[model samples]
Target chain A: MASEVKFEKVDFYYGAFKAIDSLQLTILARKVSAFIGPSGCGKSTVLRMVNRTNELVAERTRLEGRVLIADENIYDGVDLFSLRKKVGMVFQRPNPFPKTVYENIAWAPRIHGVKRTDELDEIVEKSLKRAALWDQVKNKLKSSALSLSGGQQQRLCIARSIAVNPEVLLMDEPTSALDPRATARIEDLVEELKADYTIVIVTHSMQQAARISDSTAFFLSEGAGRPGRLIEFGETERVFTNPSSRLTEKYITGRFG
Target chain B: MTRARVFDLSAKAVAWAVAISTMVFLILIIGYVVIRGVPSIASVGLEFFTTAPRGIKMQGGVYPMIVSSIYLTVLSLVIAFPIGLGAAIYLAEYAGRGRFVELIRFSADLLSGVPSIVFGLFGLAFFVYFLKMGYSVLAGALTVFLMVLPTLVRTSEQAIKAVPRSYREASLALGASKWQTIRRVVLPSAAPGILTGVILAMGRAFGETAAVLFTAGSVPQTPASPLDGGRTLTVHLFYLATQGQIEDSFRVAAVLLFVVLGFNLTAGWMMARFRRRFG
Candidate 1:
């Protein structure tokens, strides 16, 4: 089943440099929400916050406020291992494990206590098919995933995420490293996957946001040294066509980042 | 030629000269050891590895010393590997840019820089006398354990750190626990580096004379227990050479050098094979 993620007045900092400040956003259940911003605008930081990935940052960094999934505050006494299982993430680059294609998808299931070989095989096949990668990798499931093409590897990463049966899939510019052909394939896959999982993606590509996302949140840097802030959030079609803020307009029309 | 071309050619010449000189120095050292040690090898034949050391004027083999050296090296590695590797994992995976990490790193560096003789003195005082263990294999093993710990920690940390962050992120994104990510992805990639550190530590332990001399004592016999006295090949060689038994000293030196060389070569081959398997 799908789950809702809510971020309330969340602020992140690396020492004195605040990364995200007083941010509030509610991601709809089973919908694709795209966060579009220029580089270093804290888009990726926000994406990582949902899964508590920022905990991996050194202790010198600080996080405030609450990130909730399914009405539970994830940052409070929550087991990070279980939280990560429910809310999966994908990076900007295609980083499949240095394992076989089948093993890559089966790793999480195995670690989470799925020991039956037939059951794991079924999960791997189904997840790969869901990611639209099963056909291409079916014959070479035993080969190293690093041997896959960039697009194939990204899909493989997606399949790996889905095999864990995560309710929320957070992708940080997942298609930014892919070619147009691969990007289109991922775009199509995202649309199909939104029916079963809540998807949040951070992207620099406005066209990609317009093409695939259900809702769009535009963020912009406040000043030279200041961290980025949310400028606008609404339906993708309305945000792109009739943006309420000038900065959002400028960004959509390619005037300024 | 242009000025830039002239400068480039001069830089290339200097680089080549430095590289060749380094290689030549290594070759010279190795050649000298082989040439000076060959006569003793011919005299002792295979008995050097198969017989026990006898008194100064008599002819005998250094088999007891060889066995002692192997035992000490293996025991030290067994002790050092877990502690060193655990320290490395803590530094590389858990500890971040904080005062504690800096403190750990600084202490490891300081330990590495301390002379081997100081470790010997400390081992003699603490393990041999103060602790009242006496000159025994246990004391020598403990001395070597302290001697190689910093090297293993630093090298293993470097190897673990060298693994691409992308690998960790990928594994984490796939619903793996932090420990699982480290155990499955980071450790395997870092294994070759950790292994290299272990091999280097083994080499140091095998050839160590100063530390073992004070703590283990030069008892030319097989150790019946860790508490019993023993002498490694390097210590035996030093005793023979200093005692003016030229022929016996040469023979022991040759055997020790050959053993060290064989170990180094085996480690090198294992490293190469590991790279081929994992690369």
Candidate 2:
């Protein structure tokens, strides 16, 4: 169910300000690619582009060049709804809908035209099981999602997104707002999920990137109000231990960022 | 006592005095109306509510006026709700923040600020005369719709905007279209606030007098259809008070107050229920 993501000569702008500049990369299928960088390095911006969710920002924005998924150029002719159906997202914060746990998981599938009650029930159960939230929530599917703790709420959001069966899952600092235990749980979930879904995560935690990701991409900007560039990209082990770029080595050594 | 403590005590006393006096004044006004109205209704019994006027329009009941008021209020709300909600949704969700959106918002604010008498004149010239609907419930309802539209749209817009943007993002990320996101998530979350606006607008429509008087006429009869001219309760009461039919006017005032109070209470109850579910 997973697909490779390719970016070629990509340039992104918010209004007239260049955000990400002249980037080219390939994210392989069924692997977790972690984008580790300091704040405002345009990592989240790159993650959002896969689903074209960046267009939801109120300001004027433009994306130049091609982003391909499964060998299809998504920007050329793909339907926005279907593109988003194939690429789901989880945010920095837990944002479950103000609905029942069952309804939250069932919502996306219902929108994608899964109408039968029995089918919805199955999806809810399966998605919750996949997200490791079934045992805690199965007894109270009718209860509001807000009743769940912050960590459980984040998992619920994951379950809700995956219920529609997307090929790729984009996480924008999904564990940043969580506690250590919650963050660890999400990391483990990612490891399990990468077997089926192509996962891309943006994180401030370098250790998390080293611990879970297969390949890691490091992005950096020269200063404030400047465009972000990909500093380095390679297997996580080599990137952390024997990085090719001096800046990546300096950052990984905790000397400067 | 210390100067700071003295100032704090005086401020507390002033706030308490203001709050108590406002409550006292409201109760006094309502009590006065009830005293004058209830005894008269008690004397007349069921005939006061069921029968039509007799003997120079002061002898029997206000059944026709009550019927007209309900008809005009219901019709106006039915007409205004969808249009106002649509405009509100466009402003809050779809419309880009720009000069045009600001101009639209300014126009709505200006419309709500215009006096009721001016609205009455416009209703007379537009709905009653130009449109050739005559003095009827349809004309009155149309006039009331125009009068209450700004309030409905403004309140609904605030409610819709209050829904967290994250909810929209979460819905859209799952591949729901903009319309699907709005219907399933945005609208349901905004329902309680929108309902409050509608009920408040309903009270405004029901209590409206000058506009309805101009468009609906002062015919003392139950309307057979929306096209039929009729007298609303406020118009009947105005006529009664000016004609020295003090007893009937007080009774009409009492009924009007109770209905508006009922609307406010219902809004409160519904808001509590929605909050419980949504939270």
Candidate 3:
């Protein structure tokens, strides 16, 4: 599989404090890759860097080295608007705008200049169906997105993301705030989505990484006052059953993360 | 009773006494004004609202002042809203975190704190003399614009900042430009707050006397255009009282007080409605 996203010795800093150092990784196209680590291990940072979402972090945060999406370096004069259009993000919390469900999905397309009502209606329905939420919310398309339950809201966020029709979807602990049923539904959706879209997920759940990811990358915090590095990367089964690094082995076996 | 209990009882009594005194004083002033003002209002009756002030002879009417006050307020707000809102959006959403932003915020605060009389002088010097607007309603509207800009910018900035960060991130992630995000999401979310600030500013513009005294001269007849001299309620009231037309002055005071009261009630009702819908 061709590499869809690449990080080349990327060093990220929050003011004087370095969070990610000398990180090298490749996410394959149309596959689910999971980044798992203990807290503050820079897994989420790595995920956000793909689309330059970290640019919105506190003013002091600075990212050095190259982050490439497909073949182009995202940092080197890339049009941020188009780059974001091609790469969508689902945050930890399901942040639906204070708008109707239909508006939540249609807003992205509208801003991108999709004006015809019928066309927007079609896109909204299709996106919701793909996210497996159409059946539940088909009748209440005009209702406020906040009125949905936590699980449904998460799904609605996914639908909103897909509505923009991005090639890559970044999920930052998307199911962490969801119940088991909602989590399972999202996992199923992820499995279905990877056939066409490159999906990079940051998950804390070891089993979730094991069950859903095609490949897994293990990250470990280098004590205090040091940045996190990619310790090991390999096929999910191999990493779980027979890891290469001692830290990876220790992490999977739950010895001392 | 114990010492602690006695102390607590005394504290409660003091608080009650303070609160009641405030209410009592407020009622006393309004009661005296209402008692003195009503007979003049009744005697003048409909003519109070229908005819222009009869100056020097002190005929009883404030029709010109009422029209002038309304024009100044509406025109000033119309001109000030966009400029103030734009500055606020820059401070809240676009400006980087640095001393530059700090300087701008500090400047706005300082301007707001400056006495309105100083602003009147500024209007007199800059607009009336330099710009040669020449003591017209336009000059007065411009003066009030400066007077109200700080409040508008500060409150609108707060409103914009209060919009959750997630909305901005979500909008940006969806390929919307920063300008687009602000126009579509941030502005709509901050609408109620902006409107409330505007209403309060309108009230301030209506009640202002010093700022308009030089810029908007107290013309006897009603103003016909922005270039014409106009007198607001406060200016007319000042003229009436200072010239010893106490009864006419009371009628003007009653009118000013009720108009300000209406503005406050409308603002309060709007904010309450906004909170219920958004919260």
Candidate 4:
């Protein structure tokens, strides 16, 4: 449902120190884009700027340039709440609400005024199925979401995001906390979800980016106390196999982060 | 082997001694109160609660004082809950690292640390003399409201903050407005902790004597309205004890203890229920 997203000469700072510097990138519609970088290289910060979640940070922080969704500037006087609904996010750690499984899925729809119980039930089931979690939790919909295993909780978080029918789904290392099997399942789900929605994932795993992403961006910390900078961006195959920059080759070949 | 056995035995003995002593101290206080207060209850029987105070005689009841105490507690809670909760929400959710938040938090801490007698003086100077409210139930309720407001604000703020950050993010991602997220997700999750604070505030308001005495004027007769003067159960006990009506004072003290005990037990039960529901 999400159209292409474009970041044009965007710069971000926290106090005197910059976190992201003059970054330019485009995330094609209905494709999975992955940002791979070393620790503290502003990958997550870049991901957060897409939906304006970074605005929740202290007011002293600054942003420049623009992030556009479907050719409309998301940063220009748009109502942030509506922008967030269109651009949903899932964190690295699965943080489920302290509520029942059914209520977790139903929360978004209910907030948006989907008061009909039957419609809510359908949305919950379909979203769970899409997130690949319906079978494991169908019988225990009323159980507390915290009771789910780590992998299931992450999927439930995905279901929670999908239930709102967002156009874009942003993930910040969504599989980092998961085990191999769970991570594989989530990768499969992401591949399936790309048919319908635009997804931008920030991952530390180069293999994960190669496997699940259509495009990949590499970032590196410039120097001590300096903001991280974007190094290279291209198709996933080209970036991993035949990158335009030596830093991308060094990172993919396991020389260094 | 002998040294190890001796050390283990001494450690176990010390642990048992500490645990038993703590329990014994608690039991001793309860035992003393019951032993001294039971006889007074037996002397007056049900009249200790059912009949009106009869001029320093043990033959009368604590009906007016009991009713007045309940009235004041309810009124204070009604006034404090909304204001305290609103201030808490503003501090925890909206005021993020601002000067106004720091100022409010500092003032609330200062208010909590102020002694009850100081609050009584403020009530007297502000509500009684300045406002010309003059020794009424309204003055008593207002004084108790001030005494409990800081507790409610601090506790509710902690409770609201304890809600997970993910809940807010998930709610907002669903297109819910900021206030809607607070109402639907944050408040419901924090309800138990907020209720616990309210109950504690009620216990303090019910037992207060110094603040109420200065503002409420300790009228022994039943209050006809909020504007009328009244004496709460603690005030009645203070008067009888000071007036040297030892038997009557003991009766009133026993009744007050019973009421406090009943409230505490109910609050404990409610807390357990909330924990089971949400925790």
Report, for every candidate in turn, its global Cα lDDT versus the true structure: 0.87, 0.93, 0.90, 0.88
In model 2, the clashing pairs are none
Ordering by TM-score: 2, 4, 3, 1
Q: Any runs in candidate 1 off by more than 4 Å, and if so which?
A: A7-25, A58-68, A71-77, A100-102, A135-143, A225-227, B1-8, B36-43, B96-101, B172-177, B245-247
Q: Could you list the chain B TM-scores for each candidate?
A: 0.93, 0.97, 0.93, 0.91
Tens digits of per-residue lDDT, candidate 2, B1-279, equal 999999999999999999999999999999999899888788888887898989876678889999999999999999999999999999999897899999999999999999988998999999999999999999999999999999999999999999999999999888999999999999999999999999999999999988899999999999999999999999998899999979889988988988999999999999997778767
**What does DockQ come to for candidate 4?**
0.47
Query: What TM-scores do the predictions have?
Result: 0.88, 0.95, 0.89, 0.90
What TM-score would you give candidate 4 relative to the actual structure? 0.90
**On residues B1-279, what C-alpha lDDT tens digit does candidate 1 reach at each position?**
999999999999999999999999989877776677776677667876788866655467778888888888898899999999999999998897899899989999999888888999999999999999999989999999999999999999999999999999777766678899899989987887888888889989999999999888888888888888799988887877777877677666767677778777877898887665445
Q: Which of candidates 3 and 4 is the stronger one according to TM-score?
A: 4
lDDT per residue for candidate 2 within A70-128, as digits (tens), equals 98998898899999999989999999999999999999999899999999999999999
Better of 1 and 3 by lDDT: 3
Candidate maximizing lDDT: 2
Where model 2 places Cα greater than 4 Å from the true spot, the runs are none
Question: Candidate 4, which segments miss by more than 4 Å at Cα?
Answer: B1-22, B39-44, B96-101, B245-248
Name the better of 2 and 4 by lDDT: 2
